[model samples]
Target chain A: MANIAHTVHVGLGDRAYDILIGDRLLDDAGALLAERFPGRRYGIITDDNVAKAQLPRLLASLDAAGLQHSEIVLPAGESTKSWDLLGQAVEGILAARLERGDLIIALGGGVIGDLAGFASAIARRGMGFVQMPTSLLAQVDSSVGGKTGINSPHGKNLIGAFHQPKLVLADLSTLDTLSPRQFASGYAEVVKYGLIDDEAFFFWLEENQAEIFAGGPARGEAIARCCAHKARVVLEDETELGVRALLNLGHTFGHALEKDTGYSDRLLHGEGVAVGMVLAHGFSARQGLAPSQDTGRIVAHLKKAGLPTTLAEVPGTLGSTEALMAAIAQDKKVSRGALTFILTRGIGRAFIEKNVDPKAVSSFLDDMRG
Target chain B: MANIAHTVHVGLGDRAYDILIGDRLLDDAGALLAERFPGRRYGIITDDNVAKAQLPRLLASLDAAGLQHSEIVLPAGESTKSWDLLGQAVEGILAARLERGDLIIALGGGVIGDLAGFASAIARRGMGFVQMPTSLLAQVDSSVGGKTGINSPHGKNLIGAFHQPKLVLADLSTLDTLSPRQFASGYAEVVKYGLIDDEAFFFWLEENQAEIFAGGPARGEAIARCCAHKARVVLEDETELGVRALLNLGHTFGHALEKDTGYSDRLLHGEGVAVGMVLAHGFSARQGLAPSQDTGRIVAHLKKAGLPTTLAEVPGTLGSTEALMAAIAQDKKVSRGALTFILTRGIGRAFIEKNVDPKAVSSFLDDMRG
Candidate 1:
């Protein structure tokens, strides 16, 4: 039987778009985009890694569909998300002669998606853009949201805009190319949707863990499920002014850990999120909002899936608690100098807690240190 | 009797805002802002000129109203609209500890408004910003629209976003500090409203030229009338997809002249616009769209107002016609390499003309050279 695809619609009025999930979706990217943006030229932005692994497939598909395209390949890494590179990417798109009517295709992981999305957003006061996300992390998270920006020295994503893509093509087959560690890092986000507010999804993920890690039909199902949930939340609050804050389930603690690691490979974003989720659960228990058994169960699940569940599991020695606290204070979510965290009453139950006390966070960190 | 204020409300659905026009309105700035954004801190971005001449009155108002503010004063010039300075201004706002809920006040001419507005649009994924336009050019044009961006080597405003301001306070009193030459530069934009679609307003300005330039009630009335026209057009098309293009009446030729003059003091934006408007009228006659007498009348009125109305009147030699055409090609309005111009059918009868022949434009410049 042919592999069936699932379409998740992000309903944002005129800015609405669909996310197509299936194996080998890139083979159909040309047809998918041509229908929506007919006769428009394309500027494809990807990192060097993706260029080597996936560019040929995308190019062949476009060529077969009689579409014209130009490719801009930057170096592969987190460092690519900078103002200098952003300027270069924008200039590259212009150099390709892609006008406002043309489309920009982000054909790489999170970094390329962000840089290209931003370039598209500001070019001609916004041009259309499509996401051909290649990594597990991007396929499930970054590509679904319109959050596009470059990192500032002050913080990650401090300078950017909320520019949604015209369409998103998530090919699960691309996950086959990810390193085991990279794949596991993305799995962390899949686990996140369950931990956010879906008890049934969490139980399902636990039961189908092996099939998902083995890259079967279960993997695609997990990605589609996560996207559908995110799409619903985004449709309700596209700018993240209200209920969308719930989507930052492990982000507060996760961002601090990413900063502590200096945004290095020492802690991939998914890995940081995995540990952050555990810490959030632990902190909730300390505050008597959740049971200690709930925290233990979360750590056990993360460990079973080969994800780090504790700060000690991180490669480098995380300095003093004060250092982490300082990083958390600089989070984009921090408003009016108060710490805001996504705490939970139990598994699958998260809520935004604003004006959280620094002393309380400090005490919790100290206890976790043991 | 006290001068009654005029309010032009821009109807952009949820993004709607009001442009307030009055004399000595700065005295009520505190109470005005506090009511809409109560107890919110402000980050004021201005230039050295405004900081010295007008910052004191603004500071006094804020102090009297008990509002907190921090100022970032940049050197005054078009050069301040570069990426480096944009980064500095954004970083400055962050350093001031202003967050998402805080408001940024653009407290100078067009340069400050464009730079600060672009910064606020991207800072923390966008913070609210208010425009306090101090120049006639800013009050009548730039302050009304949310077109915020920085110039690139490619062309002016090639990089920007359509981020609207939350409020615009156009204090007629600020124009008192402008030099005669500076005031004339702003007068060019004032004349634009009449040329676009309001023959009655143009005739009114013609009849009251002396009083309008002499800082009388006519000046405030002219400014308010221009703002009201702009507000209505912006509400109808906030993103320049349709009628908004009508607002670029003299911009194509005006921008090319500004580029030819190196965007320097050799030709102020309004002065280039003054010449560009005449060129547009001359071009319109060349296309048989309007009578040559209309072009002559425009030149006569601009001359009476002390604004440059011909290319030869530019302070420096504007290079060859070919060079000028090159700059026009790089304009943001050029869609798919086709020239788009705002040519008039007659006074107060402007319309967008797409795919205009480059040969016709070249020949028009040749005839004007004589």
Candidate 2:
């Protein structure tokens, strides 16, 4: 079995925990969780989509490890992350009689991980949660970070908590079940690490796009490498207080697209982010902070991966340049009237620019259509 | 101005914070918050009751401190802590453009504190929050604990996060505006410290019940002392792992009473705890864990302080012994088949009992009615 490992410091003093990634880490979850949570109660939160395909293996692994557990399956999708649905999850936890020392395992993708982490955070004033990412998106991103929450009408992940998982088991085998679209969406987040801080990695992605997108051992290695980068950055800035904000390179533009599309399957997170990165690069170039060729390279690479690199390529998308800027203003990244945009001086060097003007961003969006 | 002080350690290694209490602490909330969170984006969440009585002075203080802030005044009461209301609070915070460094001040009692703290914990995956507690209950209890959440119809505080505040400013002078009932309710949590592990303090309260209930400098000192004790306990065990369970001494029975009373004004938290403590003492005596005289002292002290010490006195209350046990099972505290009841051997010495049979608890509750 292939082995991969990384660490995420939750910045919570003694309460901080780490995430461990590997091929068969599910077999090790019981031990890791038992170390942090010295109790008997264990509850697993997942969605039907995940439960049907992934829950049995998870249960079998836990059972083989001599750990007892119970499971609850939520309906699949973004709506499951609602405040109403969060209450249902909490009820399920309380109904299971979980205590402060027990653990809740999030056994699905981002939706389950976010909601379960949040439920664990609040269940008994803060208990323990384990993230068992069964999807590429969760494995590379959400599962490692302490950010967990549900969506509000005003925005996605509008209501949530910075609750780190006690342990993260990103079983690479789980990704095998992902559809092409799902796999590609996760690749978008993996590419994010390169865009944010690793120029060499960005170049590597450009060089190895075909191999990684085709899905194999090379893709797994790329996934692990990106997670390692993210984990290191997260440990240094757990609360997104400083360099961690760099991780939001494409998220500001991406969140708007997701919001505009009502977070539908038509515009998967990765697709939105793929297009978002192109826009970010274009905006950075328009501001004279990045080389113009950098924008073309990013778009070309995304297109080669069968991902949408421009807004027009995504069907049923809406928003004028003005609307997108207004949505960006609503982004958590913007402080005061100035937006903190992550721009690349070139492929390898990403920096935060707090002096970026919205009119420049709007103008860039206008140019993207041209 | 009277001086009141209590410190809380968040256990974030060197980043731990203390909650300082004083007569005019709220008068300089903006400055204290700024010291912890050096940003201008702040959103003050208050209720109509607090808005009318406290917002003007708070806003003046923020202005005098040269801080930037916006305010949202929600309707007062438990109803305001619902998901719908919390959704609106999130909208208000987003509307004000709160960022990770920005602070959201929970500027009222528990209801406002819970909702605002939850909103802060979830808004953009967590922002900074300062607890400016204006009520006796919040000052001595909820505000310092980092247990921020809202109540759902399924259960109380089932959805929340243990998001520690950046700072807590408990201005004791605000107690002057509390109704007598409100003041009495706050006193119940203060007595909890003594009942749980401080026999000397329990005896002290027994002797000084009159002075504490009178709402004076002595009362302020008692409140601070309780807060200090609680803070120290929380610092060592923030997540309620072990010793922290003792803090729930009277809460099991108290929660049942509050639920039975529909959490209305008919039974305030402390008053319910007063009755719960009496029942707990009676149950302990029956179990031969404590002397019967200890139960008498608990009831006598509560009576002298004008607090209820019997179930008959709890208005609108319902529950047979079985119902009470069922509610306890529903409590977020249960582990496995064992309930970790904080049973006192006597005043000041309490321990967890895993073998407290629910049948015995039911019988004890039935016997207590006699």
Candidate 3:
């Protein structure tokens, strides 16, 4: 009924899917779901945190569409993204007697989406999953990629399969429930779009920093735009074989920061990502590829949006570039000996570069202390 | 270079792969691997049992191909197909710095193939995997299908993904190490081809049982023929959408029997299937679909091959039809409200029937006690 029409294409041959974004999109869920999951049964996977807030609306929409559904709630956060939790969730789905054609609706943030997606990938030797993202971070990044997996004791997402979601539904209306800090944390990924590609969008965010930080329908639109950009890159390279690594622009550094805190609640993903992006830009400037003014502007924009923009600002964060390099090597983005670094020549344009010298990165780390 | 040129076709559109059968196929491992792997740093996964007996030849072949490889030897057995073992294997692969385009080689019997294939499927969001099946069961079944997974405390293959191998090498030479019992166990599946389809093959086995049971070059040819037949069926319908379910001729009963015995080595998979085939045929006869003589003849063949063909012979087996039915419901093969029963009109014409009355199945179970 609303003037809603937006799509994010994930490139994975026939396995590729679309992420549909717009206002009141949840209301139109039935038609879109019927197009993919024409089965009688639909299984919804959410977290306790999300089910309390958004389950009612999703159910009402599906009910209106005459879809029979069951729900399973998981614990919230990265802690629940374990193999044990994944197995438990799968057992719950199995209990519901979900057939091969049944849909696994991942209704929550990234953690819920990742776990549910991974579960569906293995359940019945691969089934269909739909991503219903409720957080800014999930809406922009995770909900689109087919990279599904759970964490192992050795590392995060160490155990998982490549399961693509049949569709992704990002209700702009869902972003209404957010603390200012959480909202800003998601904006970090929004800024990533510019640092990786699309300098124009980065410039647009630069101009609308105040309005974007205000958190409303406008901010939600901005988030959707960023997700659309991500979906395009993913569709081009579903497995991160080539250009998809660019999407991890700030993730290599971000993961290390998250790991340093043992992936605790001290720093949310986007907060770490914000800091990592600034540092990446700073490193680019040190390499004489990016202007210092551009790096300062990027840092200022993130700071103004209430996001952290420096390693110094992150307390209890590890400082060794060697440690960071080691972490980077462990990152999913590394291909052979070459590391795919998404860097900026300026705010409006991002490029993926390989064989980035770790010594130069170390030099950048040396300058950070001074 | 030996004449190794047989291929099994798993039908999944573009995701389909081939299983090649012959001798010294490992010599062309490079050319085959280059088509799929095409990169440096491959992960060679085998078990302690396989490593001691066969890993050298595989490594030597890789060396001849000028391929750089690393090896991870897991402890052998069904017990090792746990999350703890998978975690250790993934960590070992990561420690070796294996990347996205790099490959993982599953070299051993069914246990090693399933575990390693599953590991490759999840590691870094799915990498290339080569199936160098060293056991008869692995060659004809597990190696051809993309059904990669690990066993859980709850059930076998409760946790897994559909990650197909890039290429499969089912060298007949590997069968030389099988003990007579092991060789007989594999023969059970070989007999399955006749019970499910191809009456000619069943009659052929009837005439050639002595020669084939000798586990010589002729046995390899027979095994290859069976794999080729299965490959065509798999290629036509990779997901078991319809006709594929017929392949599970005795698996429903066999899997439950295995579960009853705690999936221990006491009852080899092939032996369990042998008894299961007899039970399934007996049930079919009770349903008036086939004559009792069919069941008698099938059971006689299994007994002649030294395979278990009766419930009383099952080691530590217990419980009622209801318990076996419950386990059947938990099977990845079950869909809707009924078990997918693979029953024959007679020898060599199996079909999958849905919604068969459970009470009839219960009565058939009661008859098995006699």
Task: Give each model's whole-structure lDDT.
Answer: 0.88, 0.79, 0.79
Q: In terms of TM-score, how similar is model 2 to the real structure?
A: 0.91
User: Evaluated on chain B only, what are the TM-scores of all the candidate structures, in order?
Assistant: 0.98, 0.94, 0.93
Task: Give the DockQ (2 decimals) of all models.
Answer: 0.68, 0.55, 0.54
Q: Which regions of candidate 2 fall more than 4 Å away from where they truly are? A: A1-39, A59-67, B1-39, B64-66
Best lDDT goes to which candidate? 1
- Would you estimate the TM-scores of all the predictions? 0.97, 0.91, 0.92
Among the numbered candidates, top DockQ falls to 1
Residue B50 C-alpha lDDT in model 3: 80
Quick one: ranking by DockQ, best first?
Answer: 1, 2, 3
- Angstrom error of the Cα, residue B198, model 1: value is 0.6
Candidate 3 clashes between residue pairs 3 or more apart in a chain or in different chains: A10-A235, A11-A235, A149-A160, A199-A348, B10-B235, B11-B234, B11-B235
What tens-digit string does per-residue lDDT give for candidate 2 at A224-296? 7876777688778887778888888788889888888877887988888888888888777777878989888
- List iRMS for all predictions: 1.3, 2.3, 2.3
CA deviation > 4 Å runs, candidate 3: A1-39, A56-70, A152-155, A317-319, B2-18, B23-39, B60-67
How far residue B238's Cα lies from its native spot in candidate 3, in Å, is 1.8
lDDT of 3 by residue, B16-85 (tens): 6667788767666766665555665679999998898788888887887788999999998878888778
Q: Between candidates 1 and 3, which one is better according to DockQ? A: 1
